[model samples]
Structures are given as structure tokens and as C-alpha cells.
Target: MVVLNWNGADDTIRCLHSLDAAALETPFRVLVVDNGSSDGSVGRIRREHPDAEILELPSNLGYGGGNNAGFRRAEEMGADEVLFLNNDTVVDSGFALPLLTVLRGEGGAGAVVPKIFYMANPSLIWYAGGEVSLRSGLVRHVGLRRHDGPRFSRPGTTGYATGCCVGLRVGVVRALGGFDEAFGMYAEDVDLSLRLRAMGLRIVFVPSSMVWHRVSGAFEGRLLRKLWLRTASTVRLLQKHGTPFSVPLFLLLLPLRLVPAAAGMFFSRLRREESV
Candidate 1:
């Protein structure tokens, strides 16, 4: 597994610890990519987990580039599969085998993702499966905030899987050239999913496999910044893989997402001015 870190040393350390300590059915090694963290994350991670292989970047490479860097390394190392996990996640000990089994068994599956729950509220679901609409080409996360139950009992294929904890078929991904760096930090997973599907690969969601995440930990309080990145990435995705109406649909829906964020920014500025 490869965990990407950017200044979240504590979270990354904890994640490494989980992997080191988890009881997996098969042998595994971890590769940590310190995405140019200014917080001394590289030094700290080296000290904490001397066993993990470290890849130190000179500067931030966004999510796509950082993971691609790791993917390339994994490819060179002759890995059959690679898991891309966010540093903010604390994975379940037995999560690996089930996902790996599906990836190996399903010849058409390019990637598989585990069920995720919010770490703060363990019973609440973060992801189950995802859908990409054929008409609008819009992607939606299934069962985002719902509580865990038997309703989501079965495994299913999805159009996209969050990069938070995805197990990838390394050879196929490397041959396809991995993620498009044009996506940067957001929607890169969706772009990868689309490209894999174009190549006749399936994206699977395994309900039996689970991971806990501190949702969007890096951009937690920077809502507007995250919004803008997402907006830009969404447009890039549409342009790259648009149906006849995809661009038009995205354009029409853009403001519905952005206007609210702009209003929030406007009000925040107004409140500051009033205080002054």
C-alpha cells in the first residue's frame, strides 16, 4: 500500500502504524510518499516507521502526481497490485484480503474500493458505491452519510471509486499511464475510473472490506479552496470525456454548486468589514 502525505505528519504516522500492525492474510509492505510537507513529516515518518519505504518529493505534486509517482515506483518494484490510501484513514485489519480477492478474481476489474465510514462517527457511512450517469455523465457517491445497515449488504460494480482507499491492478493502471495530472487534487479518481472503463475495465465496490476516514482532512476548513479545485477538475473531466450534452449539463450545474460558495465568501467578508 502507498499512503500519500502532505504536512499531516501525525495522521500519516498513525496510518503507517495501522498498516504495520494490521493482521493481513498476505504479506504486505508500505511505501510512504511525503508530498513535500513543510511540517517535518519526512523526518518524523522516518523516525516513527523505519520499516516503511519512503519517497520524498521536492514539492507538492497534488493528489494525482503524488500517487502517480508512487504508482511508478510500485510498477518498477514488480508489484502485482497497489493500494492508494489517504493518510487520514485508519484501515480495518482484515480489509485487504476481500478487496484483493475481488481484484484477482474479476478479470475485468481494474480497481476496487472498500466501504468507508467517517472515523469520527464510526456507524455512519462515507461511501458504499458510486454511479456515473450515462445521460449527464455526472458522478455521484452512493450512501454518503447514511448509517451502516444490511441494506448495503452486497458487492457491486461502480463507475468511480474514491482514491481514499482504492486497490488498483498496477499493471493495467501503469499501461494506461495512470491518472491524468490535469485533474490535480480533485476528481482524478473519477477520471481514472472513466479511462479504465473506456478500456473495458470494471470498478468494483466490496462491501465486506471497510476503512475509516477523517473526511477531507487536508482541506477541512478551506472550503472555498476545495470547491474551486473541484470545480476546475469537474470541467476538465467533462471536456475530456464528454457526451454531446456533458459540457452543457456541467455548465448549467456549475453555478448551482459555486454560487452558494461565493455567497458564503461574500457574507464572510461582510462580517469582517462590520467588525472593523
Candidate 2:
């Protein structure tokens, strides 16, 4: 497991504890990468989990760059499959086996995302594997913020899978050259999944494996804040892929991406009962 840490010591420790508890039989070593946290997170980790390998970076590289650093190290260490998990998530009980089973057994599956839910309320869905909008050039996580039900059992291909708690085969990671650091953070997962799909590989969601995530992790508040960053990432995506073949399609469907943010903003206001 490669977990990126940036002043999230408490959450990272809790997440590691959850993984240790859930993975009693799985046999995994954790590599915790600290992206120049001034909060003494590295000291805390060394004190609490002395067994974990600590990689201390000199500067605060963004999410994509930080994780890419860890990924490269893991690959160098001969890791067969790397689990890229957010520091703010806790692994569901006995989740690793199911995820490994799916990744190892499923033919043509290059990457897989676990069923994710809000950490505080596991009953609410965070995201299930699904497609990104080709027309609007938006990435949609299937069943996000919905209650999970029988519909989750149907496994299928999505245009992309989320980076939060997703597993990727080492071969595919090497093939696609890991994640694009240009993403900085947002939409890196979508870009990776899309690239894998374009290479004729499958990116899937396995319902049986689960993880609890803190939605947005560090960024929590107005929906526009989230949307603006994602929009910037989307623009980066277009720069990488949009062209004569994709420009027309993305132009026609791009507006649909805004709907989710608008709806999210409305709900956020309702929850707070006040507009800022």
C-alpha cells in the first residue's frame, strides 16, 4: 500500500490502523510518503508505526506527484500490484482479499476501484465505478452520494475509475507510465483509466471490496470550490485528448458536467440552511 500524507497524520494513522486490522492475513507492507508536512506527521508516524517505511519528500508536491513518487518506489521494490489509497480512508473489513481476487482473476482488467462510502456514514455511497461523459468531457462516479442497493452487484466498465482506494496491476501501471503528474491532483485517476481503456484494458468496480472515504478529504465546503478544481483538471484533460475526433463531442456534452456541481451546491446549502 502506498499512502500519501500531507499534514493528515491523525487520519493517516487511523487509516493504517484500519488496514492493519482488516488485513491480518493479507501480508502487506505500507509505504507512507510525507509530502513536506510541517505538522510533524513524519515524527508521529515514526513514533506510532515504526514498522512502516517512511519516505520524506523535501517539498509539498501535489497529489499526483506525491503518489507517483511512491508508486515508482513501490515498483522498484517489486510490488506486483499497488493499492493507491487516500490517507483519509479506512479499509472495510476483509476488503483486501476481495480486491486482490478480482484483480488477479478478471481477464483484461487493468485497474479496479472498490465500492466507496462516506467514512462517517458508511451507508451513503461515495462512488462506484462508472463512466466519464464523453460528450461533455466530465467524469461521473456511478452511484456517488446514493444509497447502495442491488444495483451495485452488476459489474461493468466505466469510462474511468476514481483514484481513491483503487488497485492497479503492475504491468498496466508500467505500460501506461504510471499517472500523469501534469494532473497535479484532480482528475489524474480519470486520465489514467481513460488511457488504460484506450489501450483496450478494463477498468472495473468490484462491489464486494469496500473502503470508507472522507469525501474530498482535505477540501470540504462549497461545491463550487470542488467543481472549479475539477473543471481545471477537465481543461487539462481536453488539452491532452480533445481534438478533431473529440472536440465536437466534448463541446456538445460539456454543459452536463455543471449540473452535478449545481445540484451539490443546492444540497450543501440546504444542509447548512444558509447561503454564504
The top-ranked prediction according to lDDT is 1
Q: Which stretches of candidate 2 lie over 4 Å from their true place?
A: 221-223, 244-259, 262-276
The models' CA-based lDDT, in order, is: 0.82, 0.80
> 39 in model 1: Cα distance from truth in Å?
1.0
Per-residue CA lDDT of model 1 for 4-121, tens digit only, reads: 9999999999887778656455567788888888989988988998777999999999898899999988877889999999999998888888888999994688899999987766
What digit string (tens of lDDT, one per residue) describes model 2 on residues 39-68? 999999889898889889999988888888
Flag clash pairs in model 1: none
What's the C-alpha lDDT at position 112 in model 1?
94
lDDT of prediction 1:
0.82
RMSD of each: 5.0, 3.2
Candidate 1 residue runs with Cα over 4 Å from true position: 23-25, 255-276
